[model samples]
Target chain A: MILQVAKSFILESIRNTGVFLGNLLPAFIFIICSWICTISIKSSPETLDFMIKGQFFPISIMLLVFAFAFSSATIYLADLKANNTIHLLKRTNISPAKYFLGIGLGVFLMMNFVLLLLLAGYSFIISLSISALISIILICNFVLLAIYPLCFIVAGIVKNGKVAQSLLVPIMLVFMFSITMTSLFLTINEQQPQDYYIYLIWNPMLYLSDTLQFQLNLNDHTWLPLYQYSIILTILCMVLSIFAKQIYIRQD
Target chain B: MLILDKVQKSYQNHSVLNGISSTFQYGHCYLLLGDNGAGKSTLLKCIAGDEKVDHGSIRGNEHEDVSNLVALQYQFFESYSFLKVKEVIQLFTKLIANPSNIKDLYELLDIAQYEKTLIKNTSGGQRKALSLYLAFLMSKPIVLLDEPFADLDLKKKKQLFGFLQNQVHLQNKCLIIISHEIKGLESLFDFVYIMQDGQFIEHGTTEELVEKYKNPTFSGLEAVYFEVTGQLLGGRIK
Candidate 1:
């Protein structure tokens, strides 16, 4: 049943051209920005390589994850709820857990596939070691796992797809602004800042962005080690998953 | 057979279903007739296990589980707008363990012509037809339909009435419907339930109710509804 629902979700994602393109928009924007940056830094190949690997690639992946979690996953679930598909399936004796698992599996598969493609594209522009590639994949998946549960919670609150779409821009902007601020704060400060801990603790995207920067040896001023970030993210994922299950199951 | 004993449901202290006790037997077509917000659809949801009753029990016979035995078609059918009609059918056919033959359902619902059409592009009537087809496709013994004839045209409504009747009498399936469009289709239902303010004011076979509320001013379910609720159907005057 999970596989069947996942297949149907994938088929629907493919058939819906608008959403499919929206999912790929981050990748397209990354490629175009990389092209523009490549021309400006043509004289210094090493600087260009660092820029792409250390900054562009990781930020793009973050954006991709955000897009998947909010735009694709949230709207898909909201649409199902608004259209009465969830109720219809429930009436047919399909449990909420099975349906949600199928949807989550579908989103996970599609997001990973797109991530792989982005990695493949970047490999040609810069020399990427197998270990670096693996680390990137692992970290991105961690970020996805940490962030995915929030989609269910948000979808439960915003039961209409149209409403979710309308709120997408502002929500994405807020997330981006916080992560960007954290990145700027981390880059400018050499020592661990005491006051920023409260602000920095809540934003998973900052942990994701800076951890990727640290892993690539691009930024050495990371507040925490890679393992600590992973632990924090795992905890966040668990907490969010519990809340998500409660909200989603309670939905009619 | 499905039984609801003293079923009660409420939201934020506003009672939606107030002690709705009834028995829906197999091989019979039952119509839950009421005005808007009269708990018709809520009752169906309770029976289908989509909504929990605040008080009381809803159960099928000893061998049957109410949730497992029932199939429900909601009033609005706007899901899967991106998929083609046939693809939606295929997806559900695969999800359901024992789906009825798609070919017969396609022909019965006249969905063959729209098989290639995207569901978003289909007319309201077509979507309603597709919804009806899916509800019946599950082959569940108890089928609950909420406003099955809402978006359908007169001809399509007639066709659906015939199909539902055949399912009840020939296949011995229990069919429960919530609808207010039963002027000339009185004979389609074997039993009629008149709901008012979240409670059943009267329920009986159409002939029995009409005879019980016999009046020259109105006839059929309309007469019974008027006599019981002291209001005309759709507020129409004799």
Candidate 2:
């Protein structure tokens, strides 16, 4: 049953040009930005090295995950709710849990596939071992898991797909700005100052960037151990999962 | 058989279903007639378990799960507009266990010609037909249809009525339909339920209700509806 629902969602997504383009836009933007950044960095080898060693690509990857969660996944779920697909499916005797799981799985697969392509492109710009690539993929999958519940919560709160779409741009811009600031601060302050760690503790995007840096051997200044980051993210995922379930079940 | 005992539902402070109690039996076609906001759709939603009632209970004799016994055709068919008709059918066919024959349903609904068309591109009548096709795709004991003939032409409506009548008499399925298109299709239903202000004003077999409320000014079920609810079949009294 879960697979069937997932298959249907995937089929619908591919058929809808707008949604399909939304899925690929992040990767395309990342590639274009990488190209422009590479062209400008050719003048100075030192700055080029700094850009490669810094949280540049990892932050981009993090933003990609956020883009998937905030835009495509949320809008699709909201569309399902707004257009009465969920209501129709409810009448078919399919459990809400199964329906949610199916959509989550579908979005997870599509996001990871895009991440894989983005990472594959990134590997050409900087040397990445097979193990490093796998670890990056694992980190991305973890980040997606942590953020997936937010899609449900947002969709549940929104009246329709139009509202979800309208909400996406401002939310994306805020997160993008915060994430970029955190990345720049981490790059300049490699000593991992305890005084500044307090300010960045609330930002999950920092943890994602730190985890990627740790994986890629780009920085050894992680404030918390890798296992600690996993535990924190897992806990957050659980809390959000509970809240999302409550909100979604309460809707119609 | 399905039963509703004092089923009550409300949205905010407004009561949509004010203690509706009724029994829907097998091999019978039940028609629910009401003006807008009269709880016809709400009652169907309650029966389908899409909406939780604030008071009382609804139960099916054969299964503990209400969804297992009831199949509902929603009034809105704008959902799943991204997928083709064939893909939508395939998706549901895969999700449902032991679905009815797809080819036959396509032909019955006369939607085979639009199998490759996206749902967004289909006409209103085509979408309605597609929604109906999906509702009957699964072979549940009870089927609840909300405005099944809303957007179809007169010919399509007559054909659908004939098909529904056959489904009830031959397959022994219980069909509960909510519709305002009752001019020429009165004989197809086994019972008529008139709703107003979230309650049933009257309910009986068409023949019995008409005979009891017979008048020279109006005819058939419309006359019975007029005398009982003091309103025309699909319009308010002047």
Candidate 3:
């Protein structure tokens, strides 16, 4: 059943034009837009290095948030209510926790796939800098792992998919917009991006940016540790998942 | 076998099911007949674990897992996006851990051509057929259908009832169907339960009711319903 559920997700995601568009199309546009912007700027290789170092964090963070929340919002409730899928799942021995974990895994993989595609697009258009690319991937991975538990938490509490989409929209838009704005400002005002960094320092987006900075210099190493972020988010996600499981069991 | 012992369910200050206790044995069809808002849907949902009973215990055999205990079909609200019929069937089959050929299910429901058709594009009756087919596909030992015959054409209604009867008899599966359209199926059911004022006011086999009442004036179970509940069959039932 678990494998079936996973396979169903994969098939349905690929089959549904709307879901397909929502999942992959945005990242495609983002990569294209980024490539277009870089081309229009006509930057030197040195300038490209500076831009990658300064902007990689924000861009990767935006992509991660969009992909994670998009998959979460689209699949979870629709699969449950529109098709009576959730009710059917409740009848099985498959625990809600396990089922949600499986869904999280599927969404994560899909997000990573999108990230890989975006990375390929970046390498093709811009000069491929190993450090910037690696740092971006690491940060995006962290954000995906951290936010996954919250996805199920949201899914468990929301009445249905429509409600899930409504709740997810604003948060995603805010973070995406904020990350984009901060990253653009940081990259353009490159003489000193650290001063404005305070505005988004506590932001998860800043951690990625700092990682990019670390990668660019390899000497300036004053970023929050990746292990620390992972541990915190993973624990937080587990806690939220537990709360969701309790709500689900009690709902019956 | 499924048992609900001293089940008490309420919302806010209003009670829906109060101390309702009943044991549904295996290998029989039980018809739950009641007026609107008489807790028929609530009872089935509580049994399905969609709604938690305020107080009581629902017990089944350890051998009979909860998944196999019941398959419930709600009143088709006709709300769903353009999901293909095959996708819906495959999803339910996977969830139930029951392997069902989508083609076989579609043929059984007379929706073979609807394999690739989206549910939103289907008619009311066709959607009902799809919902019923999915419920039947759960392949559980206990099947609960709420208003299974509502909005269904006479010919289709006959087909559905006949299919359900065959399931009960041949499969040895206990079928608990809740519906007002019980005239044709009343005689086929092993037991008839009438709910009124949040209680089972009358219950017995159709033949038993016929013999005990000893009146041809009460032509069928509908007459028995009007007599017991004091609500005209064709009037505002609730």
Candidate 4:
């Protein structure tokens, strides 16, 4: 039944053309748009390096927010809360764990595919050592791990699909602006002084962007220790995902 | 078979189901007829376990999971907007692990024309048929239909009741329905429960109730309300 629910999501992805476009278009557009923005600056390796450090990481985070929220939004478009699917699920004896596991798997599948797209696009457009490419992939996936659960949680909490659709753009905007602020604040703190550095550790995305900056060798020395923050953020994301799964089950 | 003991449910302060205790058996069709807002749907939801009872226990046949045994089609069910009709049908089979081929549903509902159409674009009647067809796929021991006749034209209603009759006859499932109109199904009902103000005001087998409350001039269950409860189908029933 779990596998069927998971497979059903894949089938729905294809059947709902809007879901497919909403998912694929963002990744494709983000990669192409980024490539376009960076093409003129690719003259010197330093220019490329500066752009990747200063902009690409944040852009990828923003794009990931859009993709995760949009995919979950499309899933909610089925209106499981009020609709017959949840009722059908209840009738079928599909356990909440299995149902959510299937849905979460489907969400991960699409987001991971988008990550791969961005990875391949970057590999083609930029001249990077294999190690750097691997590092960026790891970094982006970590960012995804940190963020996508929140999307699932939020999507599950919304009353219905129309409310979810109406709120998604704003939700993604808030995500983008919040993460961008974390990155920007870190940058400003780095350039000026150590006064606010300690307070900024509370932002989860700061750990993500900082580690990403560390991986790109964009920052000579990461302000927060890279390994420790990675462990913490990963643990935090796992906890959040588990919590979201619990809430989603009760909601269903 | 199913048993309910002192089932109670509420919305804030007002009660919807007040000590609904009843026993339903297999090989029977139970009709729960009531007016609008008479707690008919709420009681069905409680029986289906869609809504938790404030204080009660629902026990199905021994060694059976109640939800797995019963499939309740809510009155205003919303099908998945993103899925085409055929895809939803396919998924229903997967969920219930129905080993039977899908041809029967297609034949019964004649929804092949809308097979590829998104469920959102389908009309109210078409969606109702789809819901019933999906419920048919479950093949559970108990089938609960909350206003299953609504939004269905007479021809479609006739077809659905035919299929439902077949389910009860062949499978011996305990079929319970909450509807405003019980005209076509009156003869087939093994038991009739009339819900009023969150309680079963009257209940009996078809013959017993017909003999007690049936009007001499009228022929169908429509007049049972007037004979028993002194009201008109709760203000212009459709």
TM of each candidate vs. truth:
0.87, 0.90, 0.82, 0.85
Query: Candidates 1 and 4: which is better by DockQ?
Result: 1
Of all native A–B interface contacts, model 2 reproduces a fraction of 0.63
DockQ comparisons of all candidates to the true complex: 0.53, 0.56, 0.34, 0.51
TM-score of 4: 0.85
Tens digits of per-residue lDDT, candidate 4, B74-170, equal 5654766767888787777776755335366567577898898887788876787777776667767788887777876788778767767777788
Q: Name model 4 segments beyond 4 Å from true.
A: A1-4, A11-53, A69-78, A120-125, A146-148, A162-179, A189-204, A221-230, A248-252, B62-65, B98-102, B151-156, B234-238
Better of 1 and 3 by TM-score: 1
> Cα deviation of A95 in candidate 2 (Å)?
3.4
Candidate 2 residue spans exceeding 4 A from truth = A52-56, A166-179, A186-204, A215-217, A225-228, B62-67, B215-217
Worst 10 residues of 2 chain A by lDDT: A191-200
> By lDDT, is 1 or 2 better?
1
Best by lDDT: 1
Model 1 per-residue lDDT tens digits across residues B1-238: 8888899999999999999898889999999888788888888888887888999999978746698788888776899988899888887887777887646557766788889998989998788888888998898999999888786678777877888888999889999988778878989999999898899988989888888996688788878888888777756445
Q: Whose DockQ is greatest here?
A: 2
- Whose lDDT is higher: candidate 1's or candidate 4's? 1
Which lDDT value does model 4 have at A218? 63
CA lDDT of each candidate? Answer: 0.81, 0.79, 0.67, 0.69
